[model samples]
Target: MSSSVTSPERKKIHPHKFTLWVAMGSIVMMFAGLTSAYVVKKSQSNWLEFPLPKVFWYSTAAILVSSLTIHLALKAFKARQMGRYKNLLTVTVVLGLLFSVLQWMGFGHLQQSGVQLFGVGSNPAASFLGIITGLHVLHVLGGVIALLVIFFRAFSSSRKTYSPVSIEIVSTYWHFVDILWIYLFIFLSVV
Candidate 1:
């Protein structure tokens, strides 16, 4: 008698995952460079000083709450709770939009607070804050787009199997952005 062993098939790396990770890594490096510059510029002499906008604190809270909503949506998808998943995803999207709008308002508030991005024509500190937050806002917009894509995909026929994976990936990306914003906010506000 001859016995044969069968090996289980390995899952291939989805192209979307690779692309998403590459995008995320690029974003990480972008912020890394911005924050490093911020630190270095903050140490320079005669830096123009200005108070952080209070709206940023509100934006931070909104992002944090959105993270929780996305997390719960992922959990609901895993548990096959479609209604809960949809509700949570909707809430997450709303929160994300609110965060973006608040960030824009925060920028306006900074302007009102007399925070100039250049000091007497040449201040690195002012430029640092403006550039860093602007870049962060751009990335957050990208994240919002990714979340919208996932939300639409969730309504398809294969929703049960594929929706969870998409939601998980989008949630991961969203949470990363949220955490990045929190870090930048703290660094800018306190350091």
Candidate 2:
């Protein structure tokens, strides 16, 4: 008697979602390298140690809140509650913008405190911190742009059907950047 072989089915991810995962992986590597360099540079003489700006705490709160709002937005989208989803998404976008503004303010505060971001006589620690945090802010801005795209598409009359894939992608990215910020904040604060 011949035995038949059975194979379990494999679930496929959306191409866009897969692409996003790949991009996020690259970002992780980049940040890891940057932080490693920071650690190595910290041990060298002439490194300046300063307290992180208070505004960073507020920015962290904004990002954390934005993550929750985006998560709820995704749930609402899946539940077909368009109104609630839109409202939540709007809040997430606002929070993202707020986070960016807070970061800028924090930089300003640092400058006021005599931490030169970049110049002929800038400390390596301040320069590294500025570079790392600036990169993170750019990623956050990218997420905000993605949110805006989804927000506009949802409001468009041409949108005839719900695309959970799009919402999922944006939500995942938003959560990623949020978590990334938290990690960086903790690293900077402790180290």
Candidate 3:
């Protein structure tokens, strides 16, 4: 048999990884649609603009730090430093929770200032801000759940049986959400 028959021309990508990439691509498209609509909607005279709350600034800092922590956690996992990995995972969860809380506080701030999400007085801009950020929060919550599963598994009886696939998948998704939040934060901040 020829060597070409015995071996493929190129190694195949992992299916799970390929699926993740597809999902991420879809997410990018969805957000692009949203922001584009926002841009178009903002041109109307009814669009309302307001200063984003300072808590959002604080939340952005927290989320950025969380992304760094998750990167370190992945490294620790690869090093087989179970203790460090667990600790880092816990920290990431805390940070994720803090980010969501801060986002909720931002909503409260907007409401207190009379920026309603939906009403006769609510403008498209305020609605877009609320809907976009709210969707991002839900995605962040999903990431937090995945982190918790990984965190618990790290301490379970099967701790000796390390599966990099699950960890890697979760980490990839977590990083995606972090990047998504950063983009949304910048987008909302600008227009």
Best by lDDT: 2
Q: Report the Cα lDDT for candidate 2.
A: 0.95
Measured with C-alpha atoms, the lDDT of residue 37 in candidate 2 is 99
Residue-level lDDT of model 2, residues 1-191, one tens digit each, is: 99989898899999999999999999999999999999999999988999999999999999999999999999999999999998999999999999999999999999999999899878999999999999999999999999999999889888768779999999999999999999999999999
The 10 consecutive residues of candidate 3 with the worst lDDT sum are 1-10
Kindly list the per-residue Cα lDDT of model 1 for residues 1-191, writing each as its tens digit.
Answer: 99998899898877777778898899889888888877777777877888788888899999999999999999988888888988888889889889999988987886676676655664677678878888888878888897788777676676446445567678888998998998898888788
Task: Tell me each candidate's TM-score.
Answer: 0.85, 0.96, 0.92
Writing each residue's lDDT as its tens digit, candidate 3 over 76-191 gives: 99989989998998999999999999999999999999998777788798899988999899888998998898888887975677668777888889889888988988888887
Candidate 3 clashing pairs? none
- Please say which candidate is ahead in TM-score: 1 or 2: 2
Model 2 spans > 4 angstroms off: 1-6
Q: Which residues of candidate 3, in runs, are more than 4 Å off?
A: 1-9
Model 3 Cα shift for residue 46 (angstroms): 0.4
Worst 10 residues of 1 by lDDT: 156-165
